[model samples]
Target chain A: MRLDKRAGLSPERCFNRPGLMKTDYRSRERRRRAAWIAFLIVPPMAMMLTFVVWPLLVALSSAFYRWEGMAQGEFVGLQNFSDVLFGDHFAALTWRAFRHNLFVFFALFVVQNTAGFLLAWFIYREPFGFRFHRIAIFMPVILSTVLVGFLWKLFLDPNFGLINQLLEMIGLGGLRQPWLGQETTALPALVMANAWHWVGFPALVYLAGMQRIPREILEAAKLDGCSGWQMLTRVVWPLVAPSTTITLTLLFIGAFNWFELPYIMAGLDGSPYGSTDVLGLYFYRTAFGNQSGGLQDFGHGNALAVLMFMFIAVVATLITQYLRRREIAL
Target chain B: MTAKAQSPDPLFPRSSPGSLIAAALLVGNSVLMLYPIVIMVFSAFKTTGEIFDAPFSIPDFTYVANFTRIWGETSLPGYFINSVIITGSSLALILLLGTMGAYALARYDFPGNSAIFMFFLAGLMLPLKLAVIPLFLQMRDFGLLDTRFGLILIYTAMGLPSTIFIMTGFLRTLPTELEEAARIDGASEPRIMLSIMLPLSVPPMVISAIQNAVPTWNDFFFPLVFIQTDARKTLPQGLSVFMGEYTTDWGMLFAGLTIAALPLTIIYIVMSRQFIRGMTAGAVK
Candidate 1:
């Protein structure tokens, strides 16, 4: 009753005061830590599970069943998957789409990444106009794909298009092809637009990576009889390999799941002979009927989506594994 | 700084005139980067007849007609409102849940911990469009289809991976001693988080919020699929409708595109430094 250290306990506290105090403190600490961890974890975990993880599993399961409008449909088994993989035009469509995607990847790899690297490298040497250059080049990266698409769509309107007008003014009217409407040029045009929108991101990333490289390394390279190209190839390139991995990985995923820009600029069907028809657009069309065409084949679309997912997952995993193995993290 | 600014090379020695060529090349490239936007801006001012008749010509008059016409005559205001609500609310939820989630993973050791972390990280690669059909169906079933809340929830889910990834790294970098000091001062776990760690993590939160918000505000696909009502459609989607309605209205379409793009450009200009830093931090890590 004295309200001292041992005031409230009974015979147990009296008999084992030293041990009980230590044990009680330890237990309380443990309980407090556990409670803290629990409160921090549970709600977000539950939300992620319900929304993200569960939806993925549901999508996977739905790949097998033929359903529409929430009504349970017959089990089609591997039919959907089969159609996506080995069906008559499915093979051609997927292959063609992938080929077009490969074009996008290579184009981005060469133009966007190389330009990004060069700009970052150049800007490092000359910090004048650094702020202006950074803002101007990276401006497109901040834009939404929708906005970029719309901007370019207006820019390349063929009749009132800026590019054609510029060409005409310069007496290069023959070079003014209907960029997005031509079968030969549509895919590349889309790729160019994408590269323009995306180059800023990689440039900024690479610039940061280059900045992190120790100044002494570059100085040492200079002493070692290195020119700008030699210094870049020998010192900077190897050091910035990690950034390359990130850039490539991002570009790969973006190329595969490319949807918004094409859908916006070229329409859902990718007119002028489906030249701009990426796998993403194809899946979107399949899953949800567009302005032109078929009943919404949810099952087939899910199947196609799963197929596309597997393709991307495998390629991405391989690329990541390869790049990870090769990258010498500084 | 001004003295150094006059001479281009601050770090590297200007060993040769090749540096001048490099500067020229850099300037040219920068112009390449800026030209499309420059043309787009100019095109917005050109009259429809001028757009075709003198497509390359500068506008004769600096006019407010295009801007006034789009906003006044179109559904742009409502669409803009929808975009604001969706992006703002979604960004708030994403930052809130993402930071807390990231803090838990970064600081605490728990059951299924790595597995849980991987579950979130895996979302970084799982493109949401792949699940568009099921998601749409899920929304329909839950009576969420076409609702702003539906977009918000989905966007939150979509943004979780990157936000968590970036936030986790940002939080992990904060010294654990701060939390321990708070604890030693008789602060509860929630109190420490609410008062200490959360405030310290605001920079990364702002970065993530801006990164996530721009895309959400300009998202046309989700709104296109989900929103059916004209009043409910977001700005980008509403602009698409405007484009369709005034297919040949070059002045109006360019004006709409300009309007849609202007806010993001403004935000970018204002926060370019943070945007660059935030983007690099998220990507590099």
Candidate 2:
């Protein structure tokens, strides 16, 4: 009774003002909130500004100058961009690299991801071999990309490779061919090897998504006369849509920025008439590699970086926009 | 999905004759995966002539020569040290900052939180190869060029997105009452996070360690870009140069590849279960 009386004290008696008590509490709360927000926002903002935003600005500024690492050169505004977009070697190399990237993207997105999804569906019901199979599939992803490239390179060697030997043993001598050394076969071989390494990752992802479906819902569908095919297409597929979106987005980015496999398999020059010359290798060579080409051109390199960044930013934004709209609120 | 829950227990499920045939065909895929590695490993033991002569056969004699030659002739040990240093430091930083960043985003309701998260997530789509030139310049500017620190920083920044994303999702499921009770006990925020929160975060932390550390250890791109000097090169780059130098020495090249792959394989075997669980959790989220 005494506490209630104290709480019910008139505004004039509390804090010596009519509405001061309420005003003080609210103002204090607002100050606390403002402090919290400031604390939360400052650190990340500063880091991003220094690392991401500043470098981008510097890249843009440097694109106009023919600068070496230490020395500065005459300003060449838009020339670097033009050279990257329209000049000899740059345009062709960029186009070819983009083309190769597109091929890699489609291949991984379709062949690897689809195969992975199917495998996930198949093995979901089998608990006996599931663990072993999962490990076996995921093994390649754990290995370094360089190791993968080397391993495949050894196996794909035309003369003494196990692949050609196996072909000979299987009574198909005609099938023996240079996998990485040949122009026609090099890029495809690299793609297959890459798929071999990465397919497990997507498969594992799809499996996780499949597992998220409630057992009860699946049992009910089964009792309602749903076949495996029907359930997979009609019920299970729709529920794991988010996984599909994430997998596709990641795979798309991975494919476009493909570098390590081609670098190792096709050499830094992307040999066999530059058949495996990807944008990644091309960019690296242009920026750093010095053989017949002149010393490192920081301006052209920066322009290339900026241009690639713009391309990725645009595509990523479009994908995010589309995917965000389609995301099921499960 | 329904088939799993509904199927009656069987000693050998899918025992039908036709299904048995299908199982055999499916199991054939295993041969595709394992046979190549098996052949290569065995071939490393065989002489060059013998490798071709009995390509499918086992080696006639054990050979330590290839192993000796690779370790003796190359700077692989230095590369190994380089890889360990870069991966170790990078993983440490990534986990440290990533956890703190994740905890903040997960627990707090600060303004523009999702926007901040989206900014980190953007790194996932931005491939480092595209930014190699700029990265080189930045490293040079910071005097981190050709150093392990450069590699570590690049990897930490590069890896932040996935680590933070995964860590936040894992952290969100944790009970908020514990944090509230800690706050009520007059514990400061950092104290609560370090003493209370960090202790409860071991499992996901270990999982992230394996996932991120293994890739960083095995990473080739950044090392290839930022590092040029022989002493600073990582195992992958060292192996690349080694392969170039010993192009014709198939045995030594195979040995180098095997040596580079051994540590990861061992680590994977030991923590295979956690790796799978962590991957599933992250991917599903």
Tens-digit per-residue lDDT, A1-330, candidate 1: 223423333445546666566577667668877887877667667767666777778889999997774565989899889887788957787777778778888888998888898888877675446657777878788777877787788777687787788888899998888888889988888888888888888887887788788877887888788888888888898898888888888888888888889988998887678898888888887777788666688888888888888888999888888888767766
The docking quality of candidate 2, as DockQ, is 0.31
Clashing residue pairs found in predicted model 2: none
Q: Which consecutive 10 residues in model 1 chain A have the weakest lDDT in total?
A: A1-10
Model 2: CA > 4 A from native: A1-49, A64-77, A220-227, A290-293, A319-330, B1-13, B16-22, B60-62, B108-115, B279-282
Candidate closest to the true structure, highest lDDT: 1
TM-score of 1: 0.91
lDDT of 1 at B211: 70
Residue B199 of model 1: what lDDT? 91
Worst 10 residues of 2 chain B by lDDT: B10-19
Question: Could you give the CAPRI-style class of model 1?
Answer: acceptable
lDDT of 2 at B226: 73
lDDT of 2 at A312: 65
